[model samples]
Target: MSDTTGGLLTIAALIILLAAVHKPFGDYMAHVFTSAKHWRVEKRIYRVLGVNADSEQSARSYTVSVLGFSLISIVVLFLILVGQKALPFDRGLPGMPWDMSLNTAVSFVTNTNWQSYSGESTLGFAAQAGGLVIQNFLSAAVGIAVAIALVRGFVRSRSGELGNFWVDLVRGTIRILLPLSFVAAILLVSQGVIQNFGDHTVHALTGGTQVIPGGPVASQESIKELGTNGGGFFNGNSSHPFENGTPFSNLIELFLLLVIPVSLTRTLGTMVGSRKQGYAILGAMTFMFGAALAVVTWAEAGMHSQAAQLAGGSMEGKETQFGSWASSLFATATTGTSTGAINSAHDSLSPTGGGTVLVNMMLGEVAPGGVGAGIYGILVMAVVTVFIAGLMVGRTPEILGKKIGTKEMTYVALYTLSVPAIILVGIGLAIALHGTPGYMNNPGSHGFSEVVYAFTSAANNNGSAFAGITVTSHFFQISLAAAMLLGRFIPIALVLGLAGSLAKQGKVPVTAGTLPTHTPLFASLLVGVILLVTGLTFFPALALGPLAEALS
Candidate 1:
């Protein structure tokens, strides 16, 4: 088959797989969360925390409580980073500089994971385990809670409230994420990914002390992918041997990043009482993800050919153990879900691969996007697309019995457009200022694309970087900080707004002429709509970057 045909088929197969697994996984989640069997676990946690597990608190009050706990965690994490040098199990190169510590804390908490410091030299074992790993769970829990709130909006009967945030947060973390992460972490450890309590090991080799990294790497590695928070315990991220030891482990990491996001669509389908609609969304996500994967893999492979002595380094910054295909696949997986871990430097990717990553992020990371964020983000676009399609067909738009009205569409459109607006404006400002003269590492067009990609990644909360760019300057700091803030919060606020509006609506009954969303037809349409919308918005910016690099 042609590459395009193969790509299409791969995507189709993935969708079929997701569709087939939806009911089973959805039932599993329901059983895990709502069943009486889990109540004792919940009670124990509440008892330790000294709070009422069954409090009749309002949703707003519960949200505040969740936020309060999160804030306390952040403070604790910050202190841990600041005091790493003096902490037990310290193998640290002093503690993190104050600015870097602040950035790291914010990065992980927001699930951005935009590291400004080298990981190996700076952090100790305690900081790695307590600070970063804990945030991995908390940040992912936040995403899951937000997603569940949105799901509740559709699932409720005449209720204007979309579940309590505190309850959802606790259940999502303690019940779903913790168990899966433990199993995955143990598997990683068995595969030779490291877990330890000691300082960095020093071995005498060639008369130089080689500092061997050690920590609870395997533990964090699991949630780093599973939670969709791709912050590396080491600076090398997934490329580090301690974090991802073998090819088998690498493949497992890739699938773990994908599984939850893929499975959540099933949860969505279950909550809405229609298996087919969930399948439709999964089909669309799989199509986009597979297409990007093929493009990236082919581009990386083409660049690897010795026959093409291209001057620019395509594989220079990549890890050898995981060659072109592995790097390409990981990059594809990372972008697909807003997880920003890199086994290969994105800047070193063939322009085509780089371009694909950019487009994936620009697509709202909703091809089974960021943790809970990805699903809700894609669903927003789905709502907009359905609304538009309904207008064209001259009918009122309804999804799983929920009416698509002005209020719903307004929130969806705002949420959809917010990141792009931030990205474009940030890029425009960076270029207009000409960047710092010394910070133009690649110079000319590639340099410009680096700045664009960084801002886009930060603003979109997708933390993978075009590594060639020097973003340490005051200008980049200010610009990217702005992007991160806007990127992280706007969609969340809009999702909450959408949930509120959705919760107030009464479910409409399906009619004979109601669209069957679960079929291949709607799935195809959803994929096309996502592409059309993202393509129109980002094609120009992308052409200037990777397209230019590839053609040149």
Candidate 2:
């Protein structure tokens, strides 16, 4: 088959697969959440923590308790990071630098998983297993809790409260993520991904000594993809042999990264009592994802062709074992879900491929994005799109029985625009400063894309980078760090507030006149909205980078 035909086929196959999975996974989540069996497990956990799980608590009280527990977790993890060298479980590596500790702790807590510190040289095994791994699970759990809270808003009658945040957090972590992680971690270990307390060893290679990196890699690897926490256990990330040892392991990791994001669509439909609604959203996400994958794959393949002719520009930053297609696919997938694990250095990818990754991140990562955050984030955009379209068509906008009113539209607009505002402004300031003699590297268009992509990744909680850019400077560090924190928290706070407001409103019953969000019409509109918003914001910047590369 021709490349074009193959691309079309693959796109169709993915949509069908997602649509098929929707009902089953949706039913599974609905059953798990409403089941008495799971309640027993929640009760046990609450009992262990000395809280009366069965007590009738207000929503405000529950939210406070959940936030309080998260704060405590953050403090404990911070202490572990700060004192890892002196801690008993330290495997002899030096303790984390103060700034690095703060960055890692904040990164993990925010689910951004941005790592400024080198994994092999700086962190000890204890910190990896105890602090980082624990946060991976907890951070993902936070996303799932937020998603469930949003679901409660759609399900509840007129009430100020959605659901108990504490209960949602506990149930999501214990009942869903923990159990899945256990299975996935074991599978990873079986595939030669490491899991142990053994010290790092030196292997005698043909010419020189090579340090063989080891740690609780399997545990972190499982949740890294599962929770959409993309921080890798090693500096090389999934490209590292220990983290992804085999082709089988590679496929499994990719699937895990996609599973929850895909599954949540089903959960959304289930909560709203319409499986088609979830399918529509999934269709839209899959279409954008498939387009990204095709462009990235073609760009990389074309680069390999160019490299063959030049007999130069070795694909040095990529994994030879995985080859170009796998590496390109991984790059696309990582950004697609806001999971930043890279099997190859994106910076070295042909300009077009790297540009695709940048644009993908800039799309607010709503293409079935970060864990629970992705689905809800995209849905907010979908709501906004419907609202706009409704205005043109002279109709009230309703999505899955929830009316898209002025208040909800305001929240969506703010949430969607918040990160783009930070990213654009940060990049603009960086270029203006760097264009001066002292800071210029390449001092041209490509350099600007690197800065823009970095801020976009950080601000959107997508951690992939164009590795060529030197981001270690204080200016880059401070700017990107601020972007990461605000981009991560602001949207989350807005979504939560929207959910609270929505919970207080009565659901508008679906009628014959209601616009079906599940159909191809709505899916197409959602895609158009995503492209229009992202394209309009970033077109000039994109023309500067990938477009230039392609033309040249």
Candidate 3:
């Protein structure tokens, strides 16, 4: 009926749908990873890759496999992108420049689809489907594999082995992502998402001509959201009618981006034999997500600025089809998770609203982050929280019966610092260079925010941009690519190393002094740890940017 009613319905339906599927989908994923028997097709894939399906890997071996696989994927995809002009379904597009190709390759391979160019104008079907879309599935599977490996570390005792990386990757793709994406693609196409091989021209009633771009959008759109990979088939991303189509499809996309990450909490509980522990993590995520949504909705709807008042709301960059409330909901979902699919322009959000989303990313997107990334990210925080609590109580911290000793805390510390380090260092370098100012659309505090948002998005592997800065220069392309790669692999290596160390330890017995991490108290502490860490590290930088703009 009304936008407000539709927005409320959309929010209610999303929560209900996610809750309904949480257990079944999560348990299905658990079964997919842990089952002993493999499909004939999976076995064939193992043979092709020369992987020993029955064998397991220690954390070191698993980390090496992950790094090696991602490196190779980046190179292959880079070549494919640079050579796209000669590929089938070229669509008369030229090959991407070498730097942009490298950036795009790193972006997709890292599951951060940060685009500096318009997708329809820059990439052909061959590059879109064969390179970007394929990497979308593989990269997301890699993240799932890593998260499960970490889970195995918690589940096992006195063992160095996590699991077979190859098995996890293939099974995640074939058994989970593939089937889900197939169904989602059909649904999106039915909702008017384009799925074709060619573009055509059309004439307007005013006698002007327009070229409508078309591709296998529905297919790519499904995995892009389902996998939490945010590369859009169009420059307008989910805001484009052909990609998102309608309010119903927009709601579906939001649900798709969130479902896996939310369900993975259930998967964690199911696998670890502790649903309450999973609920603790889920509760922390839900609280932060709800808080961000509220702040953003209030800020946008209030329209506090003089210009915003004249427009009636913060409606400048939002689509008419989805009003301020719906757009704010989408913004919250996209930023809260690492989905990065936007139904509205984040750059035009009220200063307070924009700041909230920025902080959401700065909190490492653990308000239910990317597919495999969120579970592990929050789990790392959990370990840190436990360690802090243990120190306060003058007892050694243990979670799920595993001791958070020196080695584990070291890995946790590195994991905690890695993304922030990348973001800060990258931003410093970008701002120090005189050429950076040329890229900004504004020249004051708002301009500073654009720079912070770019590196923040890149380093966190969340691909959404503030849209007020141009990042197509060779400097931006290469540097942001480096940030994406380092931000992604460093933490992954540390996570796997932590999993290995934890798996090597024998479980400690819980005693009267032991802290229960699955309670509301623990969830609150976890949330506090997230906020404390992010605020401490990024508050100064934020004060100079969105904080300054919002106040002014």
- TM-score, every prediction: 0.91, 0.91, 0.99
Clashes of each: 2, 0, 0
lDDT tens per residue, model 3, 282-370: 99999999999989988887766555989777788888888888898889988888878788888888889999999999999999999
Task: Mark the 10 consecutive residues where model 1 has the least summed lDDT.
Answer: 304-313
Better by lDDT, candidate 2 or 1: 2
RMSD of 3: 0.9
Report the C-alpha displacement of residue 200, candidate 3, in angstroms. 0.8
Candidate 2 versus the native: TM-score? 0.91
Score candidate 3 by lDDT.
0.92
Would you list the clashing residue pairs of candidate 3? none
Model 2 Cα lDDT, one tens digit per residue, 1-552:
664554444445545655576567667776665554446667777778786544433345545554566567757877888888887657676666566666677778778887777788778888888798888888888887777777777777687775556566777778778888889899999889998776555657676676676677888999998888899888889999899987668777877788788888888888777778888888899899989998888877664434434755336577776766677778888999989998998877777788889889988887779988898788788888888888987898877678888888888889888988998899888878834224434446666667777888889887877756766566765677778778876776677777777777887877888877889999999999999999999898899876776576
Query: For residue 445, what is the lDDT in candidate 3?
Result: 87
Give Cα distance to truth, residue 77, candidate 1, Å. 3.1
Candidate 3: regions farther than 4 A off:
none
Error of 3 at 54 (Å): 0.3
**Candidate 1, residue 165: how far the Cα is off, in Å:** 1.3
